[model samples]
Target: MKSLWLSQAGLDTLDNTVALCPNCHRKMHSLNLEEDIIKLRDKVKNYNYK
Candidate 1:
């Protein structure tokens, strides 16, 4: 249960949130890098469109 953006602003907004599985969520926080998150986001977007 972590905020992907690591920001308090718009925290309750659906568009600002991502529902990640526990393992993935933990990994994300551990990585703790915006670039990594953005890369993952692009990958998911590309995957979904394919």
Candidate 2:
């Protein structure tokens, strides 16, 4: 698994960690935007079923 969020000071807590697939991990890192990553998080958190 790869991390969605990383920090220079280091994130040593589970709250700041997200497990991402290899491709998505690469894409997220490539995009390198916290807001975009956060949007993804929101989508996952707010997913709905119909």
Best by TM-score, which number?
Answer: 2
Q: Which number leads on lDDT?
A: 2
Q: What's each prediction's clash count?
A: 0, 0
TM-score of 2: 0.53
Per-prediction TM-score to the true structure, in the order listed: 0.51, 0.53
Predicted structure 2: lDDT: 0.70
For residues 1-50, write the lDDT of model 1, one tens digit per residue: 33346453446676566678998888887877778777777775676533
Flag regions of model 1 displaced more than 4 Å: 1-10, 43-50
lDDT of 2 by residue, 1-50 (tens): 33434554556787666677898888877877778777887876686737
- Candidate 1 is scored at a TM of 0.51
Report lDDT (CA) for all predictions: 0.67, 0.70
